[model samples]
Target chain A: MTAAATAAGAAPRRSARRRLALVLEPYLYTVPSVFLIALIMLVPLAVGLSYAFRDLVLLDPDSGGFVGLDNFRTLAADAAFWNALGNTVTWTVSSVVLQFGLGLVLALLLDVPFRGRGLVQALVFLPWAVPSFLSGLDWAWLFNPVVGPLPHWFVALGLMTTPDNLLSSPDHAIWGPIAANVWWGVPFFAITLLAALQSIPPDLYEAAAMDGAGAVRRFRAITLPFLAPTIAITIMLRTVWIANFADLIVVMTRGGPADSTQILSSYIFTQAFQRLDFGYASAVAAVLLVLLLAYAAVLVTLRQTFLARR
Target chain B: MRAHVLRRRLFRVLHAGLLACFLVFALFPLFWLLKVSVTPNDLLYSEGVRLWPSRITFDHYASVIAHTEFPLFFRNSAIVSSSTALLSTLVASGAGYGFSRFAFRGRAAIVGLMLVSQMFPLVMIVAPIFRLLSPLGLTDSLTGLVVVYTAFNVPFATFLMQSFFDGIPRDLEEAAMIDGAKRFQALRLVVLPLTLPGLAATLGFVFTAAWSELLFALMLNSSAAASTFPVGLLAFVSKFSVDFGQMMAAGVLALIPVCALFFVIQRYLVQGLTAGAVKG
Candidate 1:
């Protein structure tokens, strides 16, 4: 019996090593991708951090001097920085709110069965399929003072005497980009929320109806809880996208009409590429990174708290 | 009973009306794009808010195709977008599978790090990226644009693919393995076949992303030879006046490839979106 037990143990040990080998083999498949990611993403991240403290000029190609905190100090006093920051916050918050509100409303409306339902759903999702740059340009054309259909429609309808180029003014320029963003973003929220809406079992609604619950009451009791998780995740993703978005701004305004529509991302581009101040740009970027990290952390915490209660 | 019936009908009518309004609101821009594209340049401003132009002509499309650099821009965009899509999908699939199935020592850390990567604004890192790429003789090249786009897009693509993989069950692969197949064989035979919708979705998403990408293309490539369509569109905007008709014509033309690609891959996209919507 003892000898038999010893042989069994020895056999299992050999198989365990084989299992280890098997696991290692699966991991080896990921090596090429991991290496490339490290090279392109991870290394640049490290370089960015290091460059934030070093004065690197684009023209000279060899001029890099270590200047700790100077970039941050300069950025502190920079009026454009404050304006961009404010614009970025406004863009992110308003776009996110309108996106969620309109998306939720559309999702709710689509939740009910009606004629041409599939066609309506597809049409509502059209904006998402269009390219962001093209969308920006499209909006720019629509908002064009002379030839745009929007201002023309407004004037024809007696909303204004003359066509206003909204993108030309500081106050309205930021809203132009926001309007463009909202057009593109609402579809994602609608789709995601609609998915979440569909996942709630119909039986629950039937049961609520049997219990004499009305439409709004049933939604309050059953639908909202089930959709909360999806809503939270979608909002987090949209916030991140909006906060860092540059293409739309670049295409529409170029952070222009006197930098009124400049967000952090476009501002960083100007600092780095246009001004040729790599170090200062890096510092600004680093600050942006920290804020995003904080935002993500808060989102994760919120999600955790929400989940913990369940 | 009659009142209840009337209320139900009212609700139905309201729902349909609301959906119709939303649909029109959403699709108006696309409709206008098509409307303006076919409208002659002469009546662009003078037409004054007509739903359809007084007369339609294909002159702008003809001119854009024949008279401008539109074809070259389209070709360059196609090459860059398609290559980036294929290459990134391949890379992302491997990484995504690892993330979905494997339980390595640093798996959680790696996933977290990838999330962190998404948080950094691209503008923040554009300088360092340019600096790094300049030394490799990649700046102002199509290959450079592809590489940068692939790098920027892979993380999101990987996450997207990973979600797809996670939706697929593990039992199929285990069954294949039990049937005397090696792990890779099981993956190739059973898993890869099931992941086709995911692969197609990732390809389409990455392709569109790369095609429409302008900022990096603008900052990275200055020469006309390597310029993509979005960058090419910038040429229409000189210091003095913007060419609205030609730019709109070019924009309309640029939509064709994306529309065509989406049409081909629409099946996969629908499948991908609907796959994880409902529980099995």
Candidate 2:
């Protein structure tokens, strides 16, 4: 009777232990990644956010004390910061619209099966592999009237009065980086959209076609709806990314030709690195982060509502 | 009937025309880089607008390799990129499996945090990261770069891997577990082999990103001994603004590894991303 009672008690104890293990299993698996990210990324992020309120210049050893919104006050009156904010909007909007439009066209083109499609896809997507700095340099060289064919072609096409570099004109210099951005970014959209496109069942298109739908009608009815979610997410993510992208502009222009190409991101870099004003840089960055979060929140809400209605 | 045939042919022509336009747009910049890299120094200015040079030479490539610090930069980049890729993939795979298998508490919140992490302006953290790493002796070191890059890449890599894991059936690992293997062993013996392509895809994506990173590399590593290819090339550009041929050659060298990686993995990249896109 005592041996039977001990066996029964141990059964419950062992099963309870197993239940506890099950509860902890996922945390065990995820702890390493979460720990690393917390230590390296999130901690730095918090510290960086805190730095915005302090005078934390890189070289000034005496600059770590908190300044209580002085940086934001200074930023409010800074014309360069304001100009950069404007440029940031212009840069993000133009780049995203151009990339999305061209990428969508490329995706639709590749959707149809044809001979040599693979070769064409590989060739066209090659630009995405070129490092951004290289793309910047390559396009900068191409826009140079001294070496590249573009200025000459522009003159021949009657788009220019003379063969001159497009990157030297402050009014038009932003387009130079924007052009390079489109070239490099189109492949990303194409790849994502193509994947989404391919996932659509062929019979949906066939059914729509059989119901007296033309290409435009079928696309409006089926393709657009099917692609709506992917399009929304991709565009939202790409907008945020391109807003923060400064490598091309920095490399190609250094925000030069009268600070015309200085987006908020490059402005932040310039402030932190060139001027060593980390506090002000972080303030500007904090503003940018807030704007992006607001943008993302809006897009997510829109996507939700659109999906819900469907 | 003739009208229908004519309309179809017109559509075909329009499609091919657009494709050709894209091809030319995509290739023109690279072609120009190649053209300049090959043109001998004497003819660089004289044949500026020429589609092809009258003569081509390997002198630029030879000079960049033999005379510049590009080789050191290339080695550093390769080391940091590969290490980041391998490390991020390993960490992400574990997290990914957790996300895929378990519907535990706070799962949505964790995923939300990751998504928000991807949205922030990384420029904000540059100074903070420098300060954080400097005290730990990670500043001006390759190890510092690997650690930082791995953290930045882990979120996206985790998502990529989770989507891949979600594609896999749970029964395979369950069966292995039922046969007396531990869960980790079942993962190693059954699930991992099936996810080789996913691991490879994550590796390629992370490697390319780490290879292309310029900002942090410039900020953290000031010493030429630890500089990455992008920073090295930028320094070269400013120092030798006149050496177009040598600079283009260095640019070409930078392009090789990423292009090769992209070629191998673009197919799987599409597949992996497609899975995520549909699920979302």
Among all candidates shown, the one with the greatest DockQ: 2
Which 10 consecutive positions of candidate 2 chain A have the poorest summed lDDT? Answer: A29-38
Pairs of colliding residues, candidate 1: none
Model 2: per-residue Cα lDDT over B5-47, one tens digit each: 9999998999999999999999989989988999999998888
What are the runs in model 2 whose C-alpha is more than 4 Å off? A1-10, B178-181
lDDT of 2 by residue, A1-310 (tens): 9999999999999999999999999988788788778888888889988989999888788998999999999999999999999999999999999999999999999999889988899889989999899999999999988878899999999999999889989999999999999999999999989988988889999998888899999999999998999999999989999998999999999998999999999998898889998899999999999999999999999999999899
Candidate 2: docking tier = medium
- For candidate 2, the share of real interface contacts preserved is 0.71
What fraction of the reference interface contacts is present in each model, in order? Answer: 0.49, 0.71
Which has the greatest TM-score? 2
Evaluated with lDDT, which candidate comes out highest?
2
List where candidate 1 sits over 4 angstroms from the true fold.
A1-17, A60-63, A113-115, A156-159, B239-241, B263-280
